[model samples]
Target chain A: MSESTAQNAGKLSDDTVPSALMDGEFLQQLRQQMYRFSLLQLDDPQLAEDAVQEALLGALRNARTFGGRAALKTWVFAILKNKIADTLRQRHRFVDADQLLRSDAEEDIVDTLFKESGHWHRQERPAHWENPESAIRDKHFWRIFEACLEHLPARQAKVFMMREFIELESHEICAAAEISVTNLNVILHRARLRLRECLENNWFIREG
Target chain B: MKKCRDITRLLSEAQERELTPSERISVKLHTLICSGCRNFGSQVDILRRISRAYVRGAADEPQREEDSGD
Candidate 1:
């Protein structure tokens, strides 16, 4: 048997077969998701489109060597993430003045969680999350997590994603989001607090 | 005494930058007595781990199989 056939025979299933890469609707949905993710990071529609196009092209060009160890979506996202990082680095010099001036309109969720004396509000105290590590292995837990992430205010969600998901440095995020270091910290703090509370309410407490 | 509010912010900032010696001591002391803030700190750390796992496509794995439409 040829090399490709031999490789297929060793696999448990055909999900990773190169032919699976040709699913038109699947590819289209992947492209849209990539574009949405890129847009969230880049914040410019044109740049996001170009980054997705480039990433998809790069994925296709290297499709032959895709060993199927990772799901194709994961592989594609890895490529798009690199593409976004490159775009962010290159566009650093042209900081949009408008972004800097955008109002911090999102009400501070952190403030409400605390009180006048800086104590946790009685009702807002974070309860213990039992065996959170195990929740990582539970697929339903992630859906709740994503829902909480989605509920964050747009600015908070963007800054939080850049810090936690993209793993951007503080300086890189400040530059990209056109915000001060202090502002970034506050946004991250609020995001974390909100996400923590959200997961506590929606998942941990519910599960308990 | 450092309030849980400030202690939690310090914990979050700890993720981004090194805390001052005084800030570190304050957090250590506060969380020692405060269960809520203590839980907050670990939850945020778990948030970081979950975010990393999500990016690595942990959450997408099952969805991918469903999308295969065999």
Candidate 2:
């Protein structure tokens, strides 16, 4: 090597070593965040615990190659997210969306709506809209809300939890969910709209 | 400044604290002018708060698994 290039290479090893990349505190925070995140996704405490264990070990084993582009949490979560996605993908055994939607052509969503809750706009506007103290006092309101959230489609539910509950960035969510930014936005939008409609019809309107 | 529809669109972004300064200003201006949009924004904020609360509650609940016919 040239003398100057050789000198710079020697300084690189002195200045920074890749072996010193791992930060124990950073990894612990990553583990906690991933645990909370996985809990929201799986809705099962046992599954979340198992997932966090796997993610922590994965991060530990791969720490040497970590490039440190994003925040440590983001990097670890990116790995953990892939693990969660793979688990979900294995569990998913359903017909394609288009085929399911097409074959259920006779299943009128309007009829389903009518049976579930009538004339959504015709119902009285909720007073709880102004004061959530009443909503907090009413356990039944939350019970229905939880049911609606649980009934949401899997991908929509995942995106909603990642963004709304975990407060993860949209880019991170898009990366974790293996979806395009546009699709992630669409999923979140639909999830919120459905949640709003469901809550309005079931708790807000019915209570009124 | 954002219009009412734009303000509503930003509601989710705002809840996640993802809105840029300019976007926040746009939504702020729209909400200031439109009562309907303000009410809509309030409801969205409430929804976000409740979501977080519910998640916390779920995390704290005793671990129990029932085969609810999944």
Candidate 3:
């Protein structure tokens, strides 16, 4: 707390970032960021591990070549992004529409949460989560959040991650997933609903 | 005012695209009195931000390797 500049150290705009990249400490930070980012994209644990390893090596060995034009993350993520794309191309992933579409069973889950008049049932209303940002700061919380995501249907999770994790534009996501703009919207909607419900019930409420 | 179900959907939709002016007003009014919807909206909003941060990988201690998302 005594050193004022220390707190601002994480900002990307700070020139110290590029210098930090060469230090062993920052390399470790870069690796964890890459691993988590890769997991969301590659989806396979082993493949994501490989991608992260390759990306880290690339960044470390070529540290001198990195231009300071982007944040350290933006640079590392670009390297890892190419790695994941290569992995996806090698494996030829599938995006199944039949599976991606909302099912009656899933709708039934949502239906039970709301009444015929579209009001929330007493049991399913959202409880206040003070300091919601802290949810990401806690590792156990992230594990619970990931478990909630794991509970979703595969295609639904895929669509959700495509938007949430990769930050793809809607039209690009729809095109990549081979679903209509409307269907993509519906899938993302349901994914958020379930995750919100799960986190509210299982994490935030318990914490509060 | 929109129903809870409708408002919930709107909060979620707001994540995907811009809300219409009417839709925006309806949500503001509904969430103002509705604690449930208000909390729901905030959580959904946080979910978007934190989920991105999670991928961006917040600084934290290492945990056991667990496979999540596909």
Q: Which tens-of-lDDT digit does each residue in A1-208 have in candidate 1?
A: 2344335445434443455456677777777878888898788898898788777666655655443424677877888888888888666553444544442545454688888899999989999888977887788988898899888877788888888877889998888767789888888888899999999899889754
Q: List the residue pairs that clash in candidate 2.
A: none
Descending-TM-score candidate ranking:
1, 3, 2
Q: What are the lDDT figures for the candidates, one per model? A: 0.78, 0.57, 0.71
Residue pairs whose backbone atoms clash in candidate 1:
none
Q: Which ten residues in a row have the lowest lDDT in candidate 1 chain A?
A: A1-10
lDDT of 1 by residue, B1-70 (tens): 8888778889999999999999999998898888899999898888999898887777756555554444
**Shift of residue A109 alpha carbon in model 1, Å:** 3.4
Candidate 3 matches the true fold with a TM-score of 0.70
**Model 3, range A161-206, lDDT digits (tens) per residue?**
7777667678767666566887777777778888888887788888
Error of 3 at A68 (Å): 18
lDDT, candidate 2, residue A104? 39
Off by over 4 Å in 3: A1-54, A64-78, A81-93, A97-102, B59-70
All candidates in order of lDDT, best leading: 1, 3, 2
Global fold similarity of model 1 (TM-score): 0.82
Q: After superposition on all CA atoms, how large is the RMSD of candidate 1? A: 6.8
Candidate 3: count of backbone clashes, pairs at least 3 residues apart or interchain = 0
Better of 2 and 3 by TM-score: 3
